[model samples]
Target: MHRAERPVLEVADIFRVHGPAWRQTVQLSLGQLKVMSAIEQCRSAALGGHVLRCSGCSRTEIAYNSCRNRHCPKCQASAAHRWLEARQADLLPGEYYHVVFTLPAVISAIAWYNKAVLYGLLFDIAADTLRTIAADPRHLGAQIGATLVLHTWGSALTHHPHVHGIVSGGGLTSDGERWVACRPGFFLPVRVLSRPFRRRFLEELAALHRRGQLRFFGEYAALADPAVFARWLAPLRVCEWVVYAKRPFAGPEAVLAYLSRYTHRVAISNQRLVALDERGVTFRWKDYRAKGRTRYKTMTLGADEFMRRFLLHVLPSGFHRIRHYGLLANPVRRHNLAKIRGLLHATATGAQAAAANAPPGNLPPRFICRHCGAPMVIIDILQRSAPIRAPPAQRAAA
Candidate 1:
């Protein structure tokens, strides 16, 4: 007999059961606490939502509204789609590179505590590295455009911080006269990027340190002393700061597929969650260190530990995870794009084509009846179903 399909598991299932206890034991930032609360209530009757009816069968169902919080697992796919469509016009005519810049483990230790300052500096320095290397006469020497998305978690939900950049493979000449494409398969030399990136980042870090802008805490408190901090950074200069550029994407479609996935990815998705019971939470994660079959393994962590790993990724409030730079920077993208388009229009082959992105102001029905496979429409409204209340034990722990 065919095996029965396992019921879908969500982050909320674990959060609802253990969030209060976890919160009481561990001191959490307001942003992390808010994220936990939102995830727990997302799509639950506790948050008011509407009743929906299938148009064909008239089968009614209560569809609770989503919290629409960025970190919530259920909310990002639509958000990524809409964001991709809205920025579709930003696509350059040629191939794009998926470049990734990762912070070393030592820096990540500092980054965990000084998130806003360090993360922002990471973006700025990464962007500067790309633009600088690309603009050198020996290299591409043209002003390229890039869309950078910040990701803070590794597959195992560890605090491995990195930036994913979707960059145009080519760029415009200084005078805005023509497009300059890089060597066919390669975007930029990885070794070249690594050295400069490390140098620039360290300089920025030292500057931040010198200016008394960086804060150290707990065990890292010794880094508050400039001498100790400088000593801490000395080894980083010689180490290989990972700056890798993947092969160029085939075309615009590949770029869109990539953006759709990475731009809004949370630390973990619901689909990866296998079960949450007395044993603990079991989730599928890729062990990048292992080979083939050994790579895909399920890890079971205690509720407290799982929640701790999840909270490690909660970003500082109001920090923009997705950013644009170079020709794609907000201030001058329109004019710069027009210039690029003009250069494309002067094409010798007349092959380059233009496309406009038209995003719908209102979204169509997303939910469908499992029984009927027909679209479900909202038929009625409902109020909050239950208030999230902490237990006496949890309150005492708090």
Candidate 2:
């Protein structure tokens, strides 16, 4: 389902009314307001952009430029292409894995208030846990690279903060000699990873508390006290933290396909939106837990309630949603990727190398104007504005 369209349809009324009141409200943060404005004006003429016309038939087509913000649904296709291009050269000749590290509702509550700190903590703990475990002699005994993305919402647009990790199946040995691979069907012990992640996260939280770095208010006020913080963490120690690992992908191609679909996905899509009537907003969502989960279900929610749920996922300013760790670390990524490729090339060749190094395939051609059959150019861009006016006609000789 194209969940990206839901917001544009559902929030039409809210944009019509409270859109001007943005300057007055403090609870509605700048990020939220910016998203609201984008939702209202996206695909409309309020922001100048472009329009297309067919030369042969003289049929004018209206098209708008996307904000291209990572959070914007319409912009993700191009974003995914660019990201895949950058990573093409870095692909290793081996299996890849999809791992997810989820924060419990308890921590999610605190994260709602202190997003920057807590979200950073979540990434650090998850990455550090994987790195530490992989380096252990009992495990893979190699340093790995992981691409981590932070997602704060679930399929139904609920607040469920989690980090999704796309990890290269193997890694270079500590001395950068050989590419070490993992056993089939297993990556790391989930129990071990969960325990360490929980411990490391709590340790950092404790440090933040001692340094007076964490702000506690609303339901999280009790965490301000040291004793209360300890008690809050105690329950978490015994409960099993979920660290899900899907079966390894065939190679980097499969991994990139998964990333293209999952990465940059917003809470909802435009196509899934059915209507925005007095019954509130209606949209479709997937039930991931159910078998044959391909079926989509419709949900109706009040406008105010829908807005609240949507705003819950707006991140703090300048916060990065995607991050890299270990060999994929920014400073040494190019050098490390080159070395890794050299090693992989020594072992593998032909189709594998071509797949790893080649650029993504071309996009299909667009429809041409019927009259002149000339490729039309976008003349003006419009977002949520009045219907486009017809282009002026040229009179033929009688």
Candidate 3:
């Protein structure tokens, strides 16, 4: 059984109440609650699905259906596969890089109030920054393709909003006659990208304020004043917004692996929930900046506090976390991908063509019965609360 399937009253059980409470209170965010609930219900009868039985012994078992929501940590494997399959044809014969653009604490606070608007602004600004920088004569001088995903929480479930980007390391020149590749290991100057991102984001934010599209409340009420809002944004002018570019991925396969791991992750995984008691919840987290490979650290917080942290990540309803830009943009993606594939084929020779046509890695094997060590077959489907009849006992002799 998965960690989440264990008994209900264990220390880990704190997450159930804590996660939901936080979301309901709006102290924690909605995204966290949906993800937590999905994790708890995964492979369980609440979803009402069939289970596998032993073909030889006729041993029965129960299987639960999945929520299949995109953000569900337990449900993204198949979803990612489907997405990657569609994106396969868009691959160009070139390297890819990962870029992250992080909003400052000041902006993050504002974003906590105006989530959908500001989050959408972040995507547009960052994407525009990359496209504009790449198209500049001094840069790659081409139209780049990028995939952007929004991540709203830090490892500890703190409300730190950021955007993760997967970008082609090169792009087609404006004329489309030839491809313009970036430096083998470098995509763009972080400083340049950061500056443009801040500018575009602030410009749009100002426009929104002017149009009376932003709402301020509680401690943020001061932002409703134009002068105060402008003053509040002043510090960001000199502050360096973080723009990180990691080394190029090993290949397309590596990129997919990264996405599978990071894309669907929730506020906290079941494995991370160590114990729950009167002392609150104990959980593990990674301190990314620490050296000596001292990766895992444990934290304990009050149940209410834990819930508060977890719910701070819920996204607005109907908001999309993943987005495409440039050549991958929906309007012209089909045409762009076809053209790129043709270019790749023209460049690939005999051996490369053969390798490209090779089948991908096989799927992981399905769950099997431990008693007989054989593949289990499904014989019946059951929904929750479905009744079953028990056999009558034999009559006693006089």
Candidate 4:
């Protein structure tokens, strides 16, 4: 039986080849080390797998298991599919808006050192900003639901912290009596959202500092002083915080398509990597500042530098990257959805509602024959193999 070809290159390959040497030059946290190890072993014999035989041609092969680490670039596709299936029921027939709130570079630098506190604040404050603006009489003037996702890397893997929010275009009235819709193709104004978002975030950030919840290091070590911290924040108060809303989605289907791409993304995907060699790791990146064709381009970075940039986004241990707020909050989501559906005259339940909103596509089965295009069935299970040990030199450095 013929086995399928693996990608010419993957993050896993880079990690296995260069990670040991890189670990020697820098201090990595336990969590970071674990992530590197996971990527290196994913979908290899080290994890063990199962024997599968094709029903059509009697061809057999071994299928290894994935590491399933949330941070692994190799594993997010299936994760995203499963997540989208659950979210099908949450879709509303009304228009949906995509909103992004970004912290300036100055704040992002400190955020690198205080991810849990600062990132958590980013999610909470961004959600609060949307609800506050939507509830204002001048805006949509209702209680809207939103799903917010935090992304810490830019196209080039820089430490750019931002939250992408998917908000229902309208909301239920303050008394929960009826549905209210915003003007066609329009959501809340970005200028209005920016001011309050900026104010509340800085206010909350100062509070965290006052309580000694934030950390500073190296060049920023002076920020530990309360007076020094205030001075550092002075410029941020006057700066225009980046908050913008894209046009309303084409329909519920479009929103699902968007969610599928964004919800489970890593710092980089295997598909984007073009090559790896003595020159460096080459990959595609978009330059948002440029217009048209000029926006798309490739970048090359030394393998060591690439790995460092990728690990910068590992996240604090157990931090939740995706969150729901306002009407979409988990505890009340089902009840709130049922009520909204009633108002919209589409009060279907369970399988019926999910069917109506589900995106059109058939997810492939877990195993398929590489030779004859037939489904494969497992014939035997293989237990995990013994763990591999690092070289003595590498062990000492790590």
Q: Find the candidate with the highest lDDT and give its number.
A: 4
Worst 10 residues of 1 by lDDT: 346-355
Per-residue accuracy of model 1 over 1-398 as CA lDDT, tens digit each: 11123348889889888886777777777788788878888877788888878877988867777788888888787688668766767766678998999999999998998899989988998999999999998999999899899999999999999999999989887887889988888898999999999999999899999999988899999999988998999999998889888888888778888889999999999889998889899999999999989999999999899999998998887999999999999999978877787877733122122224234555545777767777887777899875533232334553
Q: Evaluate all candidate structures by whole-model CA lDDT and list the values in order.
A: 0.84, 0.75, 0.75, 0.90
The superposed Cα distance between candidate 2 and the true structure at residue 367, in angstroms, equals: 11
**Residue by residue across 117-198, what tens digits does model 2's lDDT show?**
9999999899999999999989999999999999999878898999999888888898999988888767888888888988
Clash count of each predicted structure: 0, 28, 8, 0
* Candidate 1, residue 214: lDDT: 86
State the displacement of the C-alpha of residue 155, model 4, in Å, after optimal TM-score superposition: 0.7
Give the poorly placed runs of model 4, Cα more than 4 Å off: 1-5, 347-365, 370-374, 386-398
Give the TM-score of each candidate. 0.90, 0.83, 0.82, 0.92
Stretch of 10 with least lDDT, candidate 3: 385-394
Using alpha carbons, what is the TM-score of model 4?
A: 0.92
Clash tally for model 2: 28
- Runs of candidate 3 with Cα error greater than 4 angstroms are 1-12, 15-42, 54-59, 346-377, 385-398
Q: Model 4, range 50-159, lDDT digits (tens) per residue?
A: 99988999998888888888899888887887788788888888799999999999999999999999999999999999999999988888999999999999999999
Better of 2 and 4 by TM-score: 4
Put down candidate 3 lDDT per residue, 1-398, tens digits, no spaces: 22135433432256455654554554333455455565556556666877677765777777677667554545666566556655555566678999999999978887988999999999999999999999997988999999998999888878989989999988888877667789998999999899989888888999999999999888999899999999988888888889999999998778877887666666666567777878988888888888665977899989888766765776786898889999889898777766776765645445344444546764333546667666677767867542211122348998
Clashing pairs in 1: none
